[model samples]
Target: MAEHRRLFFALWPDEALRQQIAAISATADWPRGARRVPAAHLHLTLVFLGDVPAERVDAVRSVAASLRVAPFELSLAGCGHFPRAEVGWLGCVDAPPALFALNTGLRQRLRTQGFALRGESFRPHVTLARGLREPPVLPDYPPLHWPVSEYVLVESRRGRAPAYTVIGAWSLAPVSD
Candidate 1:
């Protein structure tokens, strides 16, 4: 059997933003048995690549390298829950178009590279907590403005504590007017 690594592409936030997100999460009324996502693990996933064979890592990197998206401000303004997934999340009220462009471009390119992606429609969100029995009504908060400048390839290690390590990153280009 080939060795596979669990990986995904995501927007890793800086320390300040990470702390802010954590603080907001701390204030939420999570349901019993809810597991709050750790501060260090807070990220907005662009595409979940799942498990990829070790040899195919280079192909994934090449796909990311070819993407050129402009930096955009993302306003995380609301909270919601995915009942089926049993997770609560933070989402943008009005997502910037650049975000969609980048996601679509990456998915298309990855498919062309022979990677099979999930068929679900893109719903960009930051998972705040998991393992909820029923969705909680999250407290309303002011919009958290996030300046997205880069995307990264992350490796997820599951064990005593789930951890994510960023193996590669690509900077977004200037906004085209």
Candidate 2:
């Protein structure tokens, strides 16, 4: 039997922003067979819990459900590459402290629940292209800001292209309320 692996949790980008990012990626001369993530799938990943067994999904969800951080506005600015020329991604110029705190708390909670920590330090980014060689110089796009109120746990499948399936989502109540 193929093992069912649980994926990561992230805040999805809005439709307009997704379209804008897609447009930027489309103009880049990506290498052959390099797949661009679909606009609908653009998101800021919070935690990547790779390869959890199907039976453990509920436990992960319970941990996520206990997260207490309130909704906050995240602004996306600037473009950058990852692992050198191999990958390209979009990033927030200024990540609010709340974002960092939330990530740290989630990491701790998931660790207590027995999830493995990603080896690299959390440099939060939304990936645009995989297998990129020479990234194109992009014009400055206007900064994008959005209120993030929820996070979703997604399942990924590798095929001709990488695809994500939402396994569960948890909402964060507004702090002001």
Which candidate should be chosen as best, given TM-score against the real structure? 1
Candidate 2 weakest ten by summed lDDT = 131-140
lDDT of 2: 0.78
| Residue-pair clashes per candidate | 0, 0
Question: What is candidate 1's lDDT per residue for 121-143, written digit by digit as tens?
Answer: 88989999999778766677788
Candidate 2 runs further than 4 Å off? 29-34, 175-177
- Please tell me which predicted candidate would have the highest lDDT against the true structure: 1
Query: Which sections of candidate 1 miss by over 4 Å?
Result: 175-177
Cα lDDT computed for each candidate against the true fold:
0.90, 0.78
Backbone-clash count (model 2) = 0
Give every collision pair in model 1.
none
